[model samples]
Target chain A: MRETDFIGGFAKGLKVIEAFDEAKPRLTISDVSKETGLDRATARRCLLTLAELGYAAYDGKFFQLTPKILRLGHAYLSATPLPRLVQPYLDQLSDKVGQSASASVLDGTEIVYVARAAQKRVMSINLMPGSRLPAYCASMGRVLLAALPEAEARAILEASDRRANTPFTKTDPDVLMEEFARVRRQGFAVIDQELEIGLCSIALPLENARGRVVAALNIGAPAAHAAAGEMVERYLPAMREVQAALRQVLA
Target chain B: MRETDFIGGFAKGLKVIEAFDEAKPRLTISDVSKETGLDRATARRCLLTLAELGYAAYDGKFFQLTPKILRLGHAYLSATPLPRLVQPYLDQLSDKVGQSASASVLDGTEIVYVARAAQKRVMSINLMPGSRLPAYCASMGRVLLAALPEAEARAILEASDRRANTPFTKTDPDVLMEEFARVRRQGFAVIDQELEIGLCSIALPLENARGRVVAALNIGAPAAHAAAGEMVERYLPAMREVQAALRQVLA
Candidate 1:
């Protein structure tokens, strides 16, 4: 982790890739620089490199990522066993519960979805594998953070770009701290429209045989039909069964 | 696209990311060097940078990609509208057809799955977003290739790592050229046990409003129950309906 070992251009290239999101899919060099905080020259070089490598395409003014960029994520999904291992369980759980079930692991201030099984014609957010949600707001994110040491969890919370995503979102760090404690005490976390309106989700930390938290599992449904407390009363037992079952197999 | 404009280090970093797969997940500097054809010093520096950036984990000797690597793919899926636009259609089509449906776009010699909907307890391939299949053997691959000009398609076939994944796989370049012509004439493609033993699939080009083939759509079922011809007979009409409707909406 020495400073000299870092490849600044490579890191900048990755940051440039992340700078294109849902709100802005096409970006110019100056737009990328503004989004990623890199100099315009550096951003142009990275964007040009991406285009030269076939990961992106530049139409005179703006650079947009192509499907080639998925190859990068494909490497991770193909290499890792977590998604394949949890997929069957996610499928079975989602079918039985008639909702969407997913597995995700914590990464800094976000949770990245690894496996997902969505039931037909129910939920609307349409999260697939490789989707990401902010750690401060998602149910899976809260459960994963609750598994960490209090100080480390607090630091991640402090580092998060905290903002109110919905009217129900708890944006205060102190309020979020208490929610973490509640999750730790209850052995699961629940979010009622904190991420988006009409979405209610409940999550539990999926621990390995050695009791190390490897990922978090959750099932989401529409809040109109399944309230936060109702989700707990109805789905928590089934989710706990899957959690306990996963503990025996996950290494 | 100038060679001087290309950042070699950044390209090498992407190659390093691709070097990890199911058979070899945790790799050392020498293993990566061997896999990517980069020298040991260069690979070591790239690995260290990835570790520092939290994309990889280095436990003294081996460098393993963490789930954080998925953020790279997440950026693409979130930014692109194709997957979101196709999911609802995939859901309805798969449900009506009682099989699995997917959409993909061609990238180099591969077809990367962009969106997928699996009917309950039917498909075994379990292709989610970011999954890749060889463009030579897949039905969707052939349809995508057929949409290209003959010389461009032939060039791609020559560049492909042609191998008999199954005994039924057409490995000869000349034979595949004929198949591409057939696909172009018939307006669709079908594969029976080419990619895998028990899988059968049919694909049609998904043209946009301007009649440009932007992606391929397909439905896959067990080869035993639904032969390749039967799949076309049963599901082709519904798939064509979706394709025609999507043409009006997809601009």
Candidate 2:
């Protein structure tokens, strides 16, 4: 073991960052220590380093993160090949389909909105970049699941404690598995009012140059406005065209 | 001096990350060493640490960043009070104005787009959440510039050797100083075809509950479509309302 080459402090710093989550945006040193399983002294030192780097800020007794830390995400999004290349297409798709469209990649089991285009005065949900939702409940997540190897996808579904977040949410793994199979067979996914009431989404896979499903493009609208037939008739061709254009641009 | 308390490996590891810039997204190990002012061996050790933590990835001989590093930005944006509070208002303002809108904060002498309501069917520029543009030419930059202390603002203006990226761009410092004066007098900024042709923006200050100008809200549109009078008439009220709403939410 290359003990001399180990960088424990960097790991500690990242762990400190990971300890702060959606539920716990602000944390005390004790909270961080408990969350990261690090000692109080180690946690404090990591926080101090993060603060010095302008990543974390202190509010007298409580510690909160700063926007300067957004550089990391900005760095990745600006540098990434998929989001930038796919965003224009998503925009065009949104306009053509008369609905809000988004592109996202799976981050663990959750789908993160990387790029989004929405109609003016549309649905109340303010979808934008960097927003996160449970992957098991989203149309984009289902497309990603359909793209994955069967065993891996099954493992994720088995481990997931799916929530009935809304009245129509799919809480049963067996049922979700059947949905995944349908998605794979149809080469697309449709989730109707599953995550939120009155919302429906249709997702199509976007393959990179290597023909791997690196991301998913989705269009969402109210069920009343977005009839299933309309999505297939007006949106499918353009969505496929955008995917092909993405492959060309990336190629 | 608590030299022993500080982790050199960790500090060095972070320095490697700090070395990346908008100009330099990918770097070789030697480039990292030069940028961080570290010896090659030390840099290599730090890179290994970062790679192990999934923050950095090595692409053959060159080292690049990965999406896992988005955790850093997500942590900050999720925790920060300003962006979280301002985002919904920005969306509402975009809907009301029937145009794209954005909010950015100062980073050194450049303006970074922190939140945006990008429009469908518009030619997607390189501007994303982390993207940066020079402070001298952008409407948002001018609003931010007008807000700064005279000495600090003058220092930035004096040090900047502005480039005329487009025919309408104001490069001369004297001319920019006059523009700044106009913006300060009007309590708003309008940039016409400065950074890019056919692009125009109008920006106004967004004060917090304490009335400190923490950020600026800007509406961007194609110059052909965005008349100055119409923007003021249709967008100004919404912009003002959002500004008020942002302060209330944050408070």
Candidate 3:
């Protein structure tokens, strides 16, 4: 974290690329500068550098990312063992429960999906690998939070600007603390329509060879079809079974 | 390609990440320096910067990429339109043919997979989003190459390291030129165990609204069940139908 050890230009270049999103797929130089808080000349240089490397394309006016950018993500997935090791278990859990199953790890204050197996669509948003959801309301997020030390979890919660995403979302720190304690005691978390209406999910922490929680696995379904108690009764055991098998592979 | 426009530090950082692959997932500082041809001091700085940014983790001895690195790829996929627009067509094609279907765009001398749908496993390698393959030997690669200008195609071919991956692979430039011409005339490319034994595939070019060959789509099946002629006879019409529908969407 020392200033001398960091490459400031490399980080700034990445920030410029990350400025483009679904809302702003193509952007002008001024837009990039405003999005990244960089000067116009700095932004223009980053865009041109990306274009020169074939990672971005300039179509006369606006700059957009090219498919070549996918290689950065491909490199991570191909080298990482966590996603590959967790995929088969997710597939089996999805098949057994007839729902969508996913594995996610905490990144910053959000949970980034690493692997997924879908049987049916249950959410308004498409939950694929690299999809991220808020740690305050997601079941996988809560389970991951529960696995962390109390002080660390509290620090993350304090840092996040919690809001009521739905009628059932718990935005209060005290309520979330109580929920985290319950999840810690039970070894799992069940979120009942906290993220989206009619979207119910149950999540269990996945432990590594050293018995340290590394990620969380979850199954999502419609609330009308699966109540919280029913989810705990039906899905929890299967998730635990997969978690046990996954531990052996991780070891 | 101007010197002032290029950012050497950013490019070198990415090269350090790309140096870690399936062959060597965890690397020491010396390994990274050797792989990327950077000095030990420079490599150490980049690795430390990556670790500080939470994109990498150093476990005492070796450095490894973290899942957070996927955010870079996610940014590209979320901002780009091609992969999302092509997913449904790939899924329908996979469902219809009972095989794996993928869409890829040519990047340099390689083809990078952008979207995919799998009904069953068909090859020794896992073909998923973010996967890369040698363009000279892949069916999708051939279809994409055929769509380019003849001079441009020849330049790419010349730049590639042509190798006989299998006994049936056509590595000769003259023979490959003839094959490319045939594919251009026929509007599709079918390769019979050229990339790998028992792997047969047929591919069609996907055109954007500007009539540019933006990507290529292909269905892969084992040679035992689907012969090159059988694939063309049974799957070509269906692939063409999807391609026609996709062209409208891209437009």
Candidate 4:
């Protein structure tokens, strides 16, 4: 990893793009500098390049991403086969269960949604493809971690900025470790109000044809209607059926 | 834009990322150099930077994007409001019509899909959010082009690499200009096997609260079952209901 081989300017540009989230859609040079910890001059150069490329729009004082930026994500979705492979299965599971179902791959300390089928909005925020959730708090996240080696999973947990999203959320590393063991033994996981209040989810590991755990599958429902304890009894059987079906197809 | 204001390395990195698509997911440094028109040394450096930053995976000789690259696209979806606002309408329209519904904004000479709802796969390739289609051939593209001034629409058409995708495609700028006028009067456009064989679509312009056309919405079906001419009688009534409903909320 030579320093010259790594383009620092390209890396800084990505940070500037990620700096604009739901809270801050439009950012000035100063705001970008403050959010991404890049120098104002550096941020300005990146923003200008993005604007010139049609990825970002510049309106005098503010810079925001245009829909053209979706082409960057489009490259991933089109080039990668994971999302397309799991989409139909997710749709089928969501239809049969009358709930939202998703498939996500473990990325560092977070789980990134690759495919989803929405029967309805179970979360206040829309969880579509490309959505990210903390591995320590989400049902799919925990199930993905349970498939990893104990030491490796522990490292990811240690690296994460752990926080309790709800009163029921677990922040302690030791408790999370025990939960991982339980998930490994039972072949699935269920959560209630751990990510957000009044939300319950059941999840299972999706193994590839090679028997490697490539992703996790989850079915979510509003806890007011379907209790978390009951989802294991109700949704787990159907989820496992998809899991087995996906294994025959996934590489 | 000033020369110093733009980051050349950052622009080159993005080009490297875009070089991979459904046809070619994995590439070596030499392949990328040729595909992206970058020199071999520069291509190697960009790929190395992507691998070091965890956005790409370098499996010995070949390089490919990891799911982490989705973060780039997620940043756009999470920050943009148009996709989130139109998604539910697309779902409702798809459910009512029993066909695929989508919303897109015209970007240069292409229409970038912002949201989609699929009752089933109508096209040979699945059309989802972030998918792109040439503005000259798609139903939504024609409606959006009709919204623009005639000169502007002509300029976009000239800029496109127009070709016949199907036997029914209209490539003559003269014929397309007249079609645009009809779309403006009728308030919608219909395409029959213009983009692909056995595919038909009907589309209308999506207006903002100010009555400015912000995007285009369409319902696509198989031409085998639903003739392009008959789609007006079957789907237009329901599509107008959603289009009018969307006007109050879109900004």
Note the B-chain TM-score for every model: 0.96, 0.87, 0.96, 0.96
Candidate 4 local lDDT, B170-193, one digit each (tens): 999989999999999999999999
Predicted candidate 3 versus true structure: per-residue lDDT over A206-243, tens digit per residue: 99889999999999999988987799998988998999
Model 1 regions more than 4 Å off = B121-124
**Tens-digit per-residue lDDT, A1-251, candidate 2:** 17666678877887888787657888999999999999999988888777766677777567777656676677767766667677777777787778888998776677877787766534454556666777888999999988888788878877766889788898787788889899989888888788887778889888878898888988887878976556666677888888888876764
Predicted candidate 3 versus true structure: per-residue lDDT over B2-46, tens digit per residue: 798787778888788788887788999999999999999889888
Q: Report the CA-based lDDT of candidate 1 relative to the real structure.
A: 0.90
Best by DockQ: 1
Candidate 3: residue pairs that collide = none
Candidate 4 local lDDT, A1-251, one digit each (tens): 88989888889988888888777889999999999999989999999999999889999999999887777777887888888899889888888988889999989999998888877566877777788999988999999999999999999999988899999999899999999999999999889899999999989999999999989999999998799989988898899899999999897
Give the runs in model 3 whose Cα sits over 4 Å from its true position. A161-163, A224-227, B161-163
Range of the 10 consecutive residues with the lowest summed lDDT in candidate 3 chain B: B118-127
* TM-scores, one per candidate: 0.96, 0.89, 0.93, 0.94
Recovered native contacts in candidate 3, as a fraction? 0.69
All candidates: TM-score of chain A:
0.93, 0.90, 0.96, 0.96
Q: What's the DockQ for every one of the candidates?
A: 0.81, 0.50, 0.66, 0.73
Please name the candidate that would achieve the greatest TM-score relative to the true structure.
1
Name the better of 3 and 4 by DockQ. 4
Tens-place lDDT per residue, model 1, A108-181, is: 99998999988754545677788878999999999999999999999999999988888999878889989999
Q: Chain A alone, model 1, TM-score?
A: 0.93
**Tens digit of lDDT per residue, candidate 1, span B1-251?**
56777778899999999999988889999999999999998999999999999899999999999988888887888888888888889888988988889999999999999999877555455788888889999999999999999999999999999989889999788999999999999889999989888888999999998999999999988888798779888999999999998898788
